[model samples]
Structure formats: structure tokens, C-alpha cells
Target chain A: AQTVTQSQPEMSVQEAETVTLSCTYDTSENNYYLFWYKQPPSRQMILVIRQEAYKQQNATENRFSVNFQKAAKSFSLKISDSQLGDTAMYFCAFMKRGGAQKLVFGQGTRLTINP
Target chain B: SQTIHQWPATLVQPVGSPLSLECTVEGTSNPNLYWYRQAAGRGLQLLFYSVGIGQISSEVPQNLSASRPQDRQFILSSKKLLLSDSGFYLCAWGVGGGEQYFGPGTRLTVT
Candidate 1:
């Protein structure tokens, strides 16, 4: 059984500033994938970024990037130059490499970007 | 080139009512389908997933059930509704190692 944990229930950042959301997971599997998803007010889950367990390099998507520490089982999402549109609920997820794989998601952090 | 649709965007029913939520995918065939439930202000809980027609895997032991009658259509059903079952239900599709796309989601309310 795998589980994801997001310690922060809510977070706020000023516009144009930077913010980092922390995430940690518990998994015994060696090969897996980590992902960050954002859900806006529309309640649509959108992919932010992804990192493979085997890869040492962190994943970056424009303003969104990750600090993945495989040994410590930590994967944190960093938002650079945050904007008002960045206000949403961010979730960290994990999936093992196998048949019919399903994602295990964190509780989520409600992000608010204040102007 | 692929899209997913789930309806009724919102559903309201009393206790013990039957449920049938439909999810259909377009521009893709034989894609893996999933059903997830989100409690209020909570994370997603994967309830069921299907690899192909007649192949369904349930992750939670709940009152909900899922079926795939067609290659691109996945359905979630319940014989009777429970108040605890009220939440936003999401439908998603994916191919191996790729990203998963989510539908707008159906807000189910059982009173």
C-alpha cells in the first residue's frame, strides 16, 4: 500500500513571489512515478509536472518545477513568479510501474496568490 | 486528440436511490478508464479502473460498482445511495506511462 502526504492544508503567496508546496510519499516499490496535479475552481485535474523514479534530474514545466529526493522519499513542487491564476489546489501523486496502475494522491494544498 | 465526457454534471438523489453515471471517451479506443471519488475538501480516492471491456478492478470495498459495456464507455452504478457516498465523482482515461486526462466531474449528492 502506498500513501502520499501534503502537510500543509492551505498556503498563500503574494503575486510575483515564489512558493513551494511540500509532498512526501510512502512506497516500498523501487520503480515508480511522481506527479503534480492542479485543480482549479472548475474542479478539473490538470497535470503540472512529472518525475520518474529512475531519473535523478528534477522535472520542470515553465514556472512549475520539482525537488525530488528519492532517498528521503520527498517530492516538492515549486512555483516561481506566482500569479493570481496559480491559486488552486495542488496535489502530489504516485504510481507504481505495473499493470492497471492507479495513482495515490495527497490530501492537497489549497494555494492562494494574493495580489 | 482524445477527450473524455461525464454526465450529469451534478446529480441529486435521496437515500436508497439507484445511480448510473456515464463516462465516454472520444478519439481514442480501448484506453484505460478509471472512476474516482473526492469527498468535500479532500483528495481523490480511486474506486475502480478498467483495462478493457469486461476487465474491471476495484480499489475500494464500497457500495459503488463500475462496468464497461463498450470499448470507450465506462459506467459507475450503485444499487442504493448512501449519504456517505455524496461527493464529486471524476472519470479519467489514460494510456500506459502517459498522462491521464480528467473529465469535468459529476457532483453527486445523496440526501
Candidate 2:
């Protein structure tokens, strides 16, 4: 079974500053996928970014980037120029290819961007 | 463009009452549908998933059950609601190996 772990329970960043949320997972499959999702007070889960296990180049989306270390089983999310709107509960997820393709998620990190 | 819809947006039911939450997806076919629950101030726990019509896979043994009558519609039901079942229920659709798109979610309060 694959399990994602988000070590940081809560993180705070100043507006326009940068913050990184750490996540690690346990999996045996070589080819898989990792994702970061953001859930605001609105309760809508939004995709922040994703990284394929076969890709070494980190995935970047606007102000969000991920540092994916496959060997270490660590995928961390970095937020640049953070804004108040960025405050939300961030989750790390893992998905295996070719099988049931179930998505396993982390406990989550509560991010607070202070103005 | 693909969109997922879940209703009712918010529901309040008494303990031991029946529960029925409906989720539907548009702009796609034969999609993989999922049902997840998020407790207050907590992360998401996947409750059920369906690969196609009439196929349902449960992640954990709980008080809830799920069904897929149509290709794009996934339903979560419980004969008797428990207080612990009170949480925000989310519906998502995905293609294999792609990021799953989530719906606005349904807030269920079981008193």
C-alpha cells in the first residue's frame, strides 16, 4: 500500500515571501505520479501541481513549484510570492499507474499566508 | 473541458437518518469517479471509487456505501447515518494517469 506523509502540520509565510511544504511517501512502484492539492475555506480541492515519476525536471505552475526526489521518495511544494489568497490546506497525493489507480493522500499541511 | 458536480451543496440530517449524495461529471465519458470525505480541519479520505458503470470499490469498511448506476454518475449512500459521518463529501473524476478534478463538494452534517 502507498502512503503519503506531510511532516509539517502547519506553515506560515509572509506576503511576497516564499514557503515550502514537505511531503514524503512510501511506494514500491517505479512508474507512478505525485500531486499537490489545495483546499481553501470554500471546500473546493484545487490541483496545485503534479510530477511524473519518470520526469526528473520539476514541475512549475506560475508561483508554485515542486522539488521531486524520486529516490528519496520526497516531493515538496514551494510557493513563491505568496499571497493571502494562497492560504489553504495543502495535501500531497500519490497515484500508481496501470492498476486500480487509487490515489493515496497525505494528512495535509495548513498554510497561512500573512499580509 | 470537464466538470464534476455534487449536490446538495449542504445537507443536515439527524442520526440514524438515511443519506444520499449524488455526483455527476460532464464533458467526458467512461471516467473514473471517486468519493472522498474530509472531516473538520482534516485531510481527505477516499471512501469509494468506480471505474465504470455498476463497478464500485470501497477503500475502508465504514458506515457508508457507494453505487454507480450510470457512466458518469456516482452516488454515496447510507442506510443509517452516524454522527461520525458528518463531514464534507467531495466528488472527483479523472482519466488514468492524470490529475483528478474535484467538485465543489457537499457539506454533510449528521446531528
Candidate 3:
């Protein structure tokens, strides 16, 4: 069974600053996928970014980037130029390529971007 | 463009009452549908998933059941709702074994 762990329960950063949310997982599968989702007060789950295990280059989408260390099973999300609108609960997820391909989610990190 | 639709943005039902939530996907075919439940301030919990019509696999055994009657329509039902069933429900779909796309969740309150 694959399990995702988000070490930081809560994180805070000032507007225009940068912050990172740490996440780790346990999995034996060699091929899989990683994702980060954001849920604001509106409660809609929005995809921030995704990473394929076979790829060496980390995925970056503008202000959001991920550090995917396959050997250590660590995938952390870094947010740049944080804004008040960026305050939300971020969830780290893992998906295996075969079998259930179920997305295992972490506890989530509540990020607060202060003005 | 693909879009997923979930009905009844909010629902309130008494304990022991039945539950029926509907989800439909458009602009896609033979999609993988999923039902997920999120408790207050919690991560997503997968309840059921369907690869095709009438192929539902449950992740957790509970009072809830899911049915995929058509290619793009999935339904979640409960014969008798439990208080713990109170939470936000999200419906999702994926294509070509690719990334999952979520719908605006429905909040169910079992009072």
C-alpha cells in the first residue's frame, strides 16, 4: 500500500515571499505519479502540478514547483510570490501506474499567506 | 473540452434516510469515474471507482454503494445514512489512464 505523509500540518509565509510544503511517501512500485492539489475556502480541489516518476526534470508551473526525489520518496511543493489568494490547504497525492492506480493523499498542509 | 457536473451543491438528510448523488461527465468517452468523500478539514477518501459501465470497485466497505449505469454517469447511494456520512462528496473522471479531473463537490449533511 502506498501512503503519503505531509510533515507540516500548517505553514505560513508573508505575501511576496516564498514557502515550501514538505511531503513524503512509501511505495514499492517503480513507476507512478505525484500531484499537488489546492483547496481554498471555496472547497474546490484544484490541481497545482503533476510529476511523472520516469522524468528527471522537476515540474514547474509558474509560481508552483516540485522537488521530486524518487530515491527518498520525497515530493515537496514550493510556492513563490505568495498572495492572499494562495492561502489554502494543499494536499500531496500519489498514484501508481497499474493495479488500483488509486491516489493516496497526505494529511494536507494548511498554508496561510499573510498580507 | 471536458466538464464534470455534480448536483445538489448542498444536501441535508436525517439519519437512516437514503442518499442518492449524481455525477455526469461530458465531452469524453469510456472515462474512469471515481467517488470520493472528504470529511471536515480532511484529505480525500476514495469510496468507489468505475472503469466502465457496471464495473464499480469499492475502496472502503461502508453504508455507501456506487453504480455506473452508463459510460459517463456515476451514482453514489446509501440505504441508511450514518452521521459519519456527513461530508463533502467529490466526483472525478480520468481519460487514457491520465490525470484525474474533479468536479465541484457536493456537501451532504446527515443530521
Best by lDDT: 1
Model 1 chain A worst lDDT window (10 residues): A95-104
Docking class of 1: high
Q: Candidate 1 — which pairs collide?
A: none
Off by over 4 Å in 3: none
What are the per-residue Cα lDDT tens digits for candidate 3 across B7-76? Answer: 9899999999999999999999988999999988889999999989999999998999999989999999
Question: Relative to the unseen true structure, what is the C-alpha lDDT of residue A23 in candidate 1, on a scale of 0 to 100?
Answer: 100
TM-score of chain B of 2: 0.97
Which is the winner by DockQ between candidate 1 and candidate 2? 1
Query: Please, what is the TM-score per model?
Result: 0.98, 0.97, 0.98
lDDT of 2 by residue, B1-111 (tens): 888999999999999999999999999999999999988887788899998999999998999999999999999999999999999999999987678999999999989
User: Which rank order by TM-score, best down to worst?
Assistant: 1, 3, 2
Error of 3 at A27 (Å): 0.3
Candidate 1 segments exceeding 4 Å error: none
For every candidate, how close is chain A to the native chain A in TM-score?
0.99, 0.98, 0.97
Real contacts retained, model 2: 0.63
Q: How accurate is candidate 2 locally (lDDT)?
A: 0.93
- Summing lDDT over every window of 10 consecutive residues in candidate 3 chain A, give the lowest-scoring window: A96-105
